[model samples]
Target: MVRLTPAQLWRFVKRFEARVLIGLVLATGALWTFLNLAEEMSEGEIDAVDRRLILMLRNPADPSDPIGSRNVEEAVRDITALGGTALVVVITVVSVLAFLFHKKRIHALVMAGAVLAAWASSDLSKMLYGRPRPDLVPHEAYVYSASFPSGHSTMSTAAFLTLAMLVASLEPRRRSKALAYVLAALVVVGVGFSRVYLGVHWPSDVLGGWCLGALWALVGWIVLRALHAPTRGS
Candidate 1:
């Protein structure tokens, strides 16, 4: 076996170091962007795009009338339930238990912690903002909380994305990993859309929730990778 020359080895080391630095910078940028969005939202600044989108979903003649048929409304309600507190709790607990059963205690614990943190963060943001639910249209679903940074939208995204990442990490095939990510994304998007369609959350609320949820999921993924790395000098 031939060993590399000193120059070649030095170049390789520099490339590896560069990659790590780039990754750190990207993560920092993402965190900064999320914080900026939250700050703007907390200051009661509603973007025009958000208002237009919400209005489009409502009947132009009557804001009280949502623009969907009865069956469609029923389907949307069912989809939204997937992101409700009851279902989110059940899914998280079951997923954690399943991870433990597979002897992945670290993964189980990480998931549990990530979900709890996400939930607490959502609740705290809601209280801090105290933004009320949308009244432009009659709500199709029952709601009883401050609405900015929707809890269902945030929790569903965080929980489902974490689960998807965990599943993808275990899969050896590229196709399997792609499928897992796509499915997770569809679930998150559908849940967020359902909230707006049901007239309970403003478009901006869902947008903020999505941003925060994605950030929390990214943090979970990073933590998992760091934990799985071999200790230095090992």
Candidate 2:
């Protein structure tokens, strides 16, 4: 290894510290957005607009129907299934087990913990807000829970994004890392949009879920990165 002067080492540490702080900055921004959305929703300031946006995705002639061919609608349902609770849970379990089997116990724990925390937070938010599902249109999917923030959107974004980042960190190539992130993002977007398209959630509900879920994933990723960082004076 090339030994560096103390000054050079200090500069490199400073840069690394700055990069670490970027994660915190992203988490803070997402938190602020979620809080603002929650406040506006609680004040009844955005629901009307949210409903209007959701309605825009429906057939004008028949509000109960989605604006797409039958096959396209089926395709969307399949896409939405990627965010369903059963699938997300299965994915998380597989990932956690993979880590454990590889003797990466810390990674296993972190993965499981982050997904459970996301679920708990989403459930708590739903109970606290007690927001009703949209009544303006017929729901295309079965829903049995309160709908301030779509749980599927929240859970899927949190779990999938966390898993993606964890896997990306294991990849040595930058191209693979970018692809992982891109695919995760697409999944998140598709799930959030599907919630609105299915008419089970208002647009703001999906937006709120996306914000909160992204915040959790960002914070979790930061923690994971810190845990993997080289200890000082090693």
Candidate 3:
């Protein structure tokens, strides 16, 4: 087994951090490009698009529906199930496990902090947007919160992506890391789509959720990496 010396680990982290920073910047630029384009569209155009999408998602029976019919009940059940809430619960469990079971205080703190920051950002955005959930469909499941961005989508992206990233970091083989990434993408997309299918959020709402979620996850990841890295001159 090859154990990296403290200096070697620190140097590796520096290189990793620089690469991550560059990736994060590029992602932010892409998100800004999307939002700018969205902002540039005429109000009428935007409204027309939103209305059409909402009607298709929420009022599936509308004659012009493009996405086709879906069983809202099943979608509601799936969206509101374990996976939707798993991020928060799992993060708590992992933090406890890392601290108590694994006896790694720093690692536990890093995970706990990252997860909590994501949760806080999601909650804040929900409050700020205060957008109403879709009323076109008979809400088979119940929720009473603002819905500009689906919390499920936001939290799922934050949690699943972060964990997958951690797994990717720990795994040596590229194949294993790629598998973890694919699985993570599936979970994030699945959860986000479930929100729309269940008539709980607008498509734009989910898009915003993904954007904010990814941004915050990147921020959290950077913080975690810095905290986890070996100290200088140790």
TM-score of each: 0.85, 0.89, 0.73
Q: Which ranges of candidate 2 are over 4 A from the true structure?
A: 1-16, 229-234
When 2 and 3 are scored with lDDT, the better candidate is 2
Best by TM-score: 2
The segments of candidate 1 whose C-alpha lies over 4 angstroms from its true place after superposition are: 1-30, 229-234
Candidate 1 lDDT over 90-141, as tens digits, reads 9899999998898888778768877888799899989988888876778899
Could you tell me the TM-score of candidate 1? 0.85
| Candidate 3 C-alpha lDDT tens digits along 1-234 | 999999998787785566567757855863684355335332324545655666665434552332434565565466545345564677657644854464545545555665666678767867755667766655545678887566777677777676666656556788888897898788788877767666666677777667766766676556556666432211
Global lDDT of model 3: 0.63
Backbone clashes counted, model 1: 0
**Each model's lDDT:** 0.80, 0.84, 0.63
lDDT, ranked from best to worst: 2, 1, 3
Ranking by TM-score: 2, 1, 3
